[model samples]
Target: MSFLGLIGCDNGRNIRSICKNNPEICADLHKDSWCLAEKTKIIQNRYAVKDSEVTTGKQLYIQLTDLEDYSRCIELASGVQHIIHTERTADRARAFRLSTENLSVLQEQTRERQDPFMSYYQWTRFGDTDALNRFLELENTGEVSDPFLLAQAATYYSNRNAIKAQQLYLKVFAEIPFDDFDVNWLLGLASTYRQTQQFDKTYMLTKANLLLTQQKYSEQKMLALLGGNKLLAAELDLKAQTLIDSLEDASYPLSLVKIWLESQAVAADIKPETLPVHSDEK
Candidate 1:
């Protein structure tokens, strides 16, 4: 079967790049567009059902029924790797389900094929941290990959073991390049800095996070002022004032400005009148 025929390829640039990079897997390109379109339709239908059920559906059982259908559609998509390879060859769809079915199946098969002796050794060494460390060292020196150990290291650092967590989170960020890193792990780094009274690092991280999320007016202004960026605090405070004035509801707008001004005083020792008010602020 042509790779495109088996899975459909006309998805988007990422998939196209993947197909181009792995020519061996996506060797056949005939009828690729049709398959991609069909898959796309299936996925869209599934999501439509899911969205409808989430918003308007009343029957709990019926909502669950829709969810099950959505899950099955996802599983079907994941099982067809040829389709995935095909989808990579074109710029068609932005969203598609990446299924875990194949991974689960492969894991089960590997477990079935594993040597009992090695399994026994692992079982016996399970709770022995030192022995596990020795095994991990051996794996590091050898060919085996140790994702679980890496995850454990991240957990350890997240649990107040700052040094270990920083190292592991950095390593994982390098390998994974995911948004979740910024959300959870990097936030942990900021927390660690705060705990250690590393005010500079904490301020830097908090400022970076606010900028990254495009949060123009936030408590970061107070942090920035405390960290000696008076100009930035004034600018942000002015922007906040403008945003508050732009709100249609006068009551909420005034309340928001008062709340922010009060928060600034309490958090950064800056009084309300000292803040830079926009020209429109009466």
Candidate 2:
């Protein structure tokens, strides 16, 4: 066999096909009867490394997260006794056992890794302050650009440093639009406005969330934040729709909404106002 002949060979990267061709990749995992989504993601991550001679730091991070998810899902799956074939339960139990050890080993290996995303993982998962410091340093240099990571950073700062949290979350909105956005952040942003007594903005952010997710976020209390000023709340509702429109079309960074969010931080110390003042919150 000529060594040159190996260069033209191609292997499918599909998770199911990869699992079918490489038994050991998924041998320790539970069968399709349980945790299918989690197992698929884990197998996909694993398959990405099959041909690479060395996995990158990002790969290790993703593997760690995937294993954590699979372990958690399978742990729950293992407890649900099968009504028909109890062997299914046994399979999940074995997978849970293996996954627990695998996650622990990976966590230990990356506990001190200094990369930004991995540092975030360590800080959030293990409460490692040293890792958190590294992550914050990277964040300060604007290295943490991923929307999801920025959201996590914003949430971490929300309780400790209000100003930093506001800035980080502003970056999140700058980079992301309404499509597929996490609505929980809206509640956080809304509360921030309530603290500053910018009731109109609080209503805008909250209403935007309700528009997207229709989640039950206690509208009555939100009205109370506005001092029962339904007239003001009703006017701000249109602003909320405008914010959603901008976010929906990915025009938020240049839209008035972005300007408003930035402008409000400067005016945070201004007197409390419940009337329809269109400054910003999130």
Candidate 3:
């Protein structure tokens, strides 16, 4: 029997149709629905299911538009033994107003699981030496329960302890899939590399962010482009200029064009104060 057959009659048609038209899309939808289902029977019975079954489901839910389903998916994905990807996916999706409730659930789950990764005192000094000691203690304790310990360590390192931050971020970066964290972490890590004079790693991360921006050119792209990663800013600035030049010769809105150009300038580190005022006297 086909995998879609197990999704049940009501869902099977939709899943099969979506799969027939676009297999990737169908897989994503199926994964999202399966993530919300209390049991993994729908997914486990489908075919060869990987250990990342929950992770796959979370990815699908993050791409979905239904608030109710998205919320359920977040709830199910939270506090799992493995969830770096799920956390990042939920964080990015929650940036959209449609997924606010799901974001809230994820945050609540994180709060509930706080002491599991860090002690109450360690959480207080999240960016201090004590936190580092706690992280090392966790690593040495031989209880690999929470993967987000690296994430917390990276955050602390990025904030106050540059050397520690770079090491922890690199460790977390290696372990978690690229799609498993917010863009800010990537941006911060890139900036940290740049500040520590690790230009090569900075350039690599910046290029990665650029490619991601190209893949989805939304407001997030603009923010990522302008957020002080010199390499990404330089590249996006050129692209934005090319776009503006193309628009200039066409029938594009002048105001919108101005906004794009201004944003590009900001990304490129050009002072907005020096920008020429557009006169409507024409």
Candidate 4:
């Protein structure tokens, strides 16, 4: 796809220049772009369901007629990220349910800086309809000004209600520094911006993430490159994989990078086949 087709922007020059100097960024962009391309193909398949019956917290709560059995399943998949990236609605629902249940237990055990909206998330996830209504009734009556609480509340509404989520994220963004170096909230806000068609904001946040990541690991990446130009590509690829694995949901940022880099790669004259061809193959 063309640059405009992928990210609907003219930031190609900036992307190309930055990525050329930063092979780690280039490698990461390539991986994410490929994954996103595959995801798009999967999404275009007819067998993929148009709407997940139980994808949302509310829907899962209602569909899990046997709460105990489903809850057990949720417990098992508690740490799985990218729940929404699945092609299967059932899988997505299961992951969401597990996350909510896990959070519920963790909230009870810890007495530290607790997210004020823990009850809200827990009740919504398990489909405790009556309880959720009661909690919302009490919680919504007052204005929530706590930065941590507002961010958590925003996350609760994320994906389920995009507009509301965007609003909450915007508020939180104002409170947080631009150079926070924290991935969680920044990424969340960027997703909301993209969903809301705020492409400029999305591009800015995505670029910031790239710059932050590059700066953070510049020393290590440079050392690998200096070892030998011959091993640089392989070394960068390994580092990218390690970084992707460390993320809660690598695909999210990867998708963003893929979109921007699709065009950037072209502008920089970067061919898709970055690896050195084998002598036998050649």
Tell me each candidate's TM-score: 0.36, 0.78, 0.34, 0.31
* Comparison by lDDT, 2 against 4, better one: 2
lDDT of each: 0.40, 0.75, 0.43, 0.42
- Cα displacement (Å) at residue 114, model 4: 13
- Badly placed stretches (over 4 Å) of model 2 are 1-14, 52-58, 81-87, 177-180, 216-220, 265-282
Better of 2 and 3 by lDDT: 2
**Model 1 whole-model lDDT (C-alpha atoms):** 0.40
Tens-digit lDDT track of model 4 for 135-250: 44543664455455567667877777767766665555445433432556655765665565543334334434544454332333223223333354444444444333433343
lDDT of 3 by residue, 102-198 (tens): 4455434443232324342334423545545654566546442343556665676685766666656555544554345445555566666555554
- Considering TM-score, where higher is better, how would the candidates rank from best to worst? 2, 1, 3, 4
Q: After superposition, how far is residue 69 of candidate 2 from its true place, in Å?
A: 1.8
**Once all C-alphas are superposed, what RMSD does model 3 give against the true structure?**
15.8
True-structure lDDT of candidate 2: 0.75
lDDT of 1 by residue, 1-282 (tens): 343442354455434544455543233222244345433433333333433434321122222333334345444444455555765433222212222342233334333222222222333324544444544454445422333345444555565665555555444433442322334444555455445444334444444454445544445334443465666555554544443233323343245433432221223342221221112332
Question: Which residue pairs overlap in candidate 1's backbone?
Answer: 7-83, 9-86, 9-87, 11-92, 15-88, 16-88, 16-89
- lDDT of model 3 at residue 13? 56
* Local accuracy of candidate 2 as per-residue lDDT tens digits, 1-282: 221232233322354566778888999898855777788778766866777897766788789889988998999989999989988888889999999998888888877678888988888888889989998899889888878788888888777776677777888888875665787887677666666566567677878877777555555566665666777778778878888888778988889877876676422333433422222332
Give the backbone clash total of model 2: 0
